[model samples]
Target: MANKVYNFSAGPSVLPEQALKEASAACIDFENSGISILSMSHRSKPIENMFAQTEQYLRELMGIPEDYDIVFLGGGCSLLFCMLPMNFLDQNATADYALTGVWANKAYKEAKQFGNALAACDTKSETYSRIDKNLKLSDNATYLHVTANNTIYGTEWHNFPKPKSGFLMADVSSDFLARKINVSDFGVVYGGAQKNISCAGVTVTIIKKGLLGKVNRTIPTMLNFQTHIDAANMFNTPPVFAVYVMNRTLKWLKDFGGVDAIEKVNRSKAALLYSALDNSKVFVGTAAKEDRSIMNVPFVFNKDVVAADKADDLAKEFLEFAKARGLQQLKGHRSVGGFRASIYNAMPVEGVQALVDCLGDFEKKVLG
Candidate 1:
């Protein structure tokens, strides 16, 4: 067994050990306030300070503009699927979605409930192996929504599409803060905190204030983005502990040289695994080389090495073998039926090397 285990789950995945340690201490006595962070009141001074710090850290890390408002809410990313259209899709314009993967498709479906929704570009026919650079949308499009990273299919938009008319909204759930991005390029950017940032229970949204109140229909108080923004993300009781942990994680990220430095490291880690896959005789990458995600690398046992009929059994065997060696959560999404190694920002390079070694060892055993 390896000396230490490395987690590679797609969501609710690995986080910085130091951040976890700090959070652990805060859980007992937050900021010496004589109460656990989990028990701290959302309306307290400490919690308010944490919220400001969290937003500031995010703004500094992502270069979010002053015109944008950052809000942390309780519902997961899926809830935003409905909330987005409710708040932004107008009666006269259509909500256009780039269907890159399952999540994008889900968002597009939700948009339909509000008004005219269009599938601007759908790659499902291609098994979502690649992202389309061009999208089909009419002149009256309200917004063009794109999923920046598709964790399930192991694809990412290396180059963002520029809409000729409407603003771009991105669901960056899987790749948030993994690399540097121009926050100004999108009208709204949102993601669940569990993937690359922190823990579950909090969803972060960065939206341009001008985009709100444009839809013709009235949105419910909670579904309205302006409500959270106007209330300073304290419309109701906030997810206190999750946001606190996120603040610590962001601090860790900043101390680790922020997104730019981490992007280089993330790319290096991904290259190590992708290079191994490229040279392997028994494994093949699922996503296209050009559109491959640096965070989630999904590969399958080569059909030549293991016949199609036996691929599932081989995958099962490989997962067990990997887990026994302390390489955990190496299984792919159920939809894909292969192996997905989600090497998020917190994953160390040594972990990737260990997984590479396991791949080689497993290939030898399978061949024998």
Candidate 2:
């Protein structure tokens, strides 16, 4: 701890320090190749090897099967919001979505614009504080789309619902590549790399080989998943720097025992913060315990000490206080009016313990 602050932004969030250092060293002349990854031609052997290794590492880290086509596409997960429907949704076929939070709603809205889409279940009325377990799937649905984690509302689906129809698709943007998951459960799993994998600029899409090519809709070449798959994700100039950094991060993950080890640390960090909230009289968690997200934890100050209108003020104060004490990005998203602490894979157990200690100290100083 060199008096540095911990970052917890939802996306474009924290990355492993070792990865950052390695990237910094390679920024100028990557392995003495005399060219930065950014300056290299996408078709060059050096860059090609980088791309191949990165893709292979990602597949190995996540245990992705050989049948799945792993493509590193440009544009964030938001782009897939449009591409998924364009590639999968036929004229008469409907897609079913489970709206758990802001991101899920965005995906649903985009899918509806392209073709018929239905919400299997939505918790908007309750401000997305919990997951809807009793969702009714459509028999005619071409695919069931769901967001595995709600970064803003701090809700996550620990156990995914089985779709009754054709295939299962998930936008695990915030939680993808963070924990151990069965790759066979989903036909398509896509995520923006900014959250747990790397920085912004690239999105990873894993699609089962046979599940594509059914849609009669004519998708643009760039937006089509098969285009990138056919080109080995070099269809256009990919996000070279971002992909390089992701490769470094994936290597770091493997060095640290991959997803299983990181997941244990994640669980411990989340448990510590949740325990602090549960034990403290000054704080209360907003999301349901069972459905709470391990990556992003949302909590509110006690109503008796902090009014609803002043909640923002209190949060701002807490942000400043935590910043001074080496904690960073603890403020919640604007959509949900509470404080959020995003403990992604990069966040260590010590950081969570420090946050818990800060909470106790703040409570003692302010409300005691």
Query: What overall lDDT goes with each candidate model?
Result: 0.91, 0.88
Clashing pairs in 2: none
How do the residues 245-324 of candidate 2 rate in per-residue lDDT, one tens digit apiece? 89999999999999999998898899899999999877889999889899999888989777888777777788788888
- Report the poorest 10 consecutive residues by lDDT, candidate 2: 1-10
User: Which tens-of-lDDT digit does each residue in 201-235 have in candidate 1?
Assistant: 99999998688897788788988888988899889
TM-score for candidate 1, residues paired by index: 0.98
Worst 10 residues of 1 by lDDT: 87-96
Number of the predicted model whose lDDT against the real structure is largest: 1
Error of 2 at 14 (Å): 0.6
The local lDDT score (0 to 100) that residue 272 gets in candidate 1 is: 96
User: How many residue pairs clash (N, CA or C atoms closer than 3 angstroms) in each of the candidate models, in the order given?
Assistant: 0, 0
